[model samples]
Target: MSERRPTLRERQRSETRRVIQAHAVRLFTDRGYDAVTVADVAKAADVSAMTVFRHFPTKEDLVLIDQPARLIAERVAASPATHPLVRRVGGALVDAATALTGRDGDEPAANERFLLDCLRLMVSTPALRARHLDSQYALQQAIVDALGDDTADPDTAFRAQAATGACLAAMHTALTRWAEDNGQTELPELIARALAASFGDDVVATGRRD
Candidate 1:
């Protein structure tokens, strides 16, 4: 089935968000996250402070707002049910990250720069680093919701949630390394390597592990 195009309102909201984020990041970069206020971002975006708040609730959110929880959940839900939970969630997470970044090592330079800046902001700033945990929790909840009927089963829920947590941790490590290396290396490869090292083939690969 063909994907539905975004409606006019959706497009407008996205543009508004883009403008707000661009202004926010530039200001944050130029003056530092601590120094720049939401009012500053709002003014820079040529919008009201309320408009900026509507798009980004907390100051930390402007930097940490790109979590692809819905995308990850959708991918996991659409995957074959027969697959192992870890593989399904891990593959979905990887695919979602790849989708945001385009080809393995070749995301558009601007997009890559944006991600690098966000990653650096999250890593270097103490408050953003603390808020990062909440984003991870939100991602975990998304995976659990994607499990659907499986979430009702205690053992299945436990396993699914565990896998989600582990996968998110692996992803965090990969992202941090990507920032550390200045995005020179491919992110998908880093993420894949992290998952493999953390989970081993038995859990990460498909089919029975006999």
Candidate 2:
């Protein structure tokens, strides 16, 4: 069965976000992220600052909007938690990394360029780097919820949170290194290696533990 197409409203919203982000990136790259204001981005995109804020709550969000929190949560929710928590969390994050990097290995070349620019900005900007840590907490909570761990059980909660944290930390290391390398290495491979190192040989290229 074919997947349902997005509604007209959803399509328009997505297009608006795309246009705003494009203009924002251009301005930031041309005139340093610190020098460019949200008002500057709005003027370049020909939209109001209100519109920009509605789409991206903060200036840092314009560079860091595309996180994998929802994707990871959904993937974790789809699987049964019969396996070890570390394996479940590790597998989910590794799978999200593969999807973002390119499942078919044919994601547009333009997207690769865009990601590299965004990653570079995040690495160099102090405000964006700080905001990035906040996003990490949100993503960890999402995974914890998806796993449906018993919040009242101290041991179970710690295990769930620890597993998610370790996986996220591994992915974060891989991503930062990728930015430093200027995207020279394949992202999925870096993520796979990082997870394998953290998990001690359980993670595979396919992101399957079994």
Candidate 3:
């Protein structure tokens, strides 16, 4: 027989995973992360607690699991080969933001609200906060590896880490400010302003080089 594709069992497993994640997010949002237990998620998902754990090793993983790590990696990889690493990464971020915002705009606003709620939970819950920071650090390291120069003595690793950290900090600051402002302003605009301020004229100059 030819190599077997995903069987019905596999499909069902995948669906179960999605359902568990959906229920977990709902419980986290409604009851708060700490208040919601694995049993609660299981009840909401109509699955057993073991199934939930099978999908996500920890409760915090459920919240952070769907983050777009692969998408970010792909965006960085798709940048112009001739561009400087920092410029390429920055351009990739802009592109990612545009892709995420959607054409009509309301979708992006909804997403921002959801993200804000998630961040707020992370901040209030110690375990979730630790997991969030750990996840972010891992992403930063991945970006740094993507930007590293093979021939440079000390390498561009430090710059990559700094740039990625700065970008993330800018976005977090913008989101927190927007949350405090009662969602009066558009998140994309705030993000753009933050990027401009952080990167200054380098953004324009970098774009021109391409």
Candidate 4:
């Protein structure tokens, strides 16, 4: 089957979202996250405040905009059915890191300062930090849905949660470490290394005892 392309409205919506995000980032960088309001972002982006809210449901979402839930879900949905759940999630995260870093392979994006700044803001702001935790739980639930019907079984659900937690915990560790390092290191590398360190030789193995 041929893949579906986005409609014109969808394209326009995406472009508008990008414009709003760019403006919001600049505003946040200049005046700090708490100081800038959604109205300020709307004015800078040359759109109405309602439009800004339509694009980003919350003020903190302007900076925490990357859709980790959707990204991981799509990759998990695309994986081969026979693949182990843990490996599928691990591979999904590697793919997500690559996409986030804007590289097909191991290379990183040229300009990650903006992302680092956004992460820093998320760290320092209580609202954004809380939203970050919410996002993580949402991502885990998305992963559970993508991992198929087996999650309905109690044992399978436990394994699913373990696998999801391990992968996401690795990702969070990598993000914090990268921000602390001032982004001197490539984010994709840090993410990959963190995943490897967490899973070691058995990315497919769930930590459940028999």
Deviation of model 2 at 195, angstroms: 1.3
Residue pairs in collision within model 4: none
Q: Which one is best on lDDT?
A: 1
Q: Where does candidate 4 stray beyond 4 Å? A: 103-111, 202-210
- Model 1 lDDT per residue over 69-156, tens place: 7878888888778877778887887777777676534544677778778878888899988888888898798888987987798897
lDDT, candidate 3, 66-106, per-residue tens: 44555566677666667665566666555555455443444
Clashes of each: 0, 0, 0, 0
Task: State the lDDT of candidate 4 residue by residue for 62-162, as single tens digits.
Answer: 98765656877988888776767767887787777657666435444543666787788888788889998988888898898898886889899999999
Worst lDDT run of 10 residues, candidate 4, spans 201-210
Report lDDT per candidate: 0.82, 0.80, 0.68, 0.80
Candidate whose TM-score is highest: 1
Candidate achieving higher TM-score, 2 or 3:
2
Error of 1 at 123 (Å): 0.9
- Against the true structure, candidate 3 reaches a TM-score of 0.78
TM-score of each: 0.89, 0.87, 0.78, 0.86
What is the per-residue lDDT of model 2 for residues 1-210, given as tens digits with 9 covering 90 to 100? 999999999999999998999888878878899999999999988999999999998888898755578878888887665777767777777777666665235443566667778878877889988988898999998888887754348788887898789888998999998889877787767877888887777554435634
Q: Candidate 1 vs candidate 2: which has greater TM-score?
A: 1
TM-score result, candidate 2: 0.87
